[model samples]
Target: MQTRTALSLVAIAALTACASQPMRAPFSQADLPAAVQVPAGHTVVMETAAAGDITYQCRAKKDMAGQFEWVFVGPDAGLKDRSGKVIGKYYGPPATWENNDGSKVTATQLAVAPNGAANIPLQLVKANPAMGMGAMQGVSYIQRVATVSGIAPASTCAKANEGANQLVRYTADYIFYKAM
Candidate 1:
C-alpha cells in the first residue's frame, strides 16, 4: 500500500510539473495592418517582442487641461487578431511627458495577442465597455520629454530595447507622423 501511494504521488508530481513548464511565448511582429494608414509625414516604429509580437506608438497632443487622453472621437481604437478578426481596442489612462505636465500620448490599438499576454511580461490597464466587459494590453504608446533620460535603450543588452519610467516598463514601437 505504501508503494502504491508513492507511485500515485509521483504521478501527480509529474503531471504538475508538466502543467507548469513554461513555453517560449508565441508572438511575432507582423507588418502593420493595412487599414492603419498614417499620413505622408507619419512613420511607424515597431517594437519586437522576444516571444513574437509587436507594439506600435503614435505622436499625439495634450488637451488644454494639461492632460492628453483619448476622448473617443468616433470609435475606440481597433486591432486585428492573427486570424484577422476585429478583436479589440486599446485603452488607458492619460499620460504626459516626464516633465511640464501636459504632453500626453494614448494607446490607440493593440494586436490582441491570444491568451491575454504580450509574449512577454508587461504593465497593463483597460476600461469598462458597456456591459462592464473590457480589455487590456501592454502599452503601445507612451510620452516622454527630450529631457527625460533613458527612454532609448542601450545597444548591447538582451532586452536593450526596453525602457522604464516612474510608472511602467515597456519596449516602444513608435510611429512618427508629419504633414505632407
Candidate 2:
C-alpha cells in the first residue's frame, strides 16, 4: 500500500540520520587546564581481592606507556560448579579505563590462562553501555556484566580444573586507576 511505502521511507530516513559518526574531543588541548597532562597508561595487574569470580586491578599511562593513552589490565575467572572446576579464566573489562571519554572503553578482552584471549570489540562497548547523571544523590544505580563464553582451552590445565560439571557464574574484575 502507498501508506506502507511512505511509512517505510520515513523510518529509513530517521535511521540514516542516526548513523555513527567519528568521536571528537569535546574540548581542545587549549581548553584543558595548564596542569592537565595526557595520561601514560593505566593497568590493574592481578592482586588480592575476589568478587563474582574475577580478581582485577587498574593502572594508568604515567606508570605504563610513554604517551597519554589509557589502558586497563585485569583478570576474569570462570567456573563450572558441578565439577568443582574452572571452565575458563581471564580478566579484562569490555569497557576499560574503568571507562572512557567521560565513560568506559568499548573493547573487552577475556583472556584464558596460559594463552587464550577473547576480544570483545568496541562496538559492543557502544552497544551495552553505562548511564550517567550528574549530582544524582540517593540514586541506586546498577549494571550487568556481559559474558564472553566458551573460550577454547589451552593444552595444559592447571589446578583450576577439577569439578563435577555444574552451572556456575563467571566473573571479570576491572581495577580502575584514578589518574587515567
- Candidate 2 residue lDDT tens string, 62-96: 55443232122333443222223332223355432
Q: Model 1 — which ten-residue stretch has the worst lDDT?
A: 143-152
Off by over 4 Å in 1: 1-30, 40-92, 97-117, 120-169
Which one is best on TM-score?
1
lDDT of 2: 0.30
lDDT of each: 0.29, 0.30
* Pairs in steric clash, model 1: 27-52, 27-53, 28-52, 28-53, 41-178, 42-177, 43-176, 45-174
Query: Which candidate number would show the highest lDDT if scored against the true structure?
Result: 2
Q: What stretches of model 2 exceed 4 Å from their correct place? A: 1-130, 134-150, 153-170
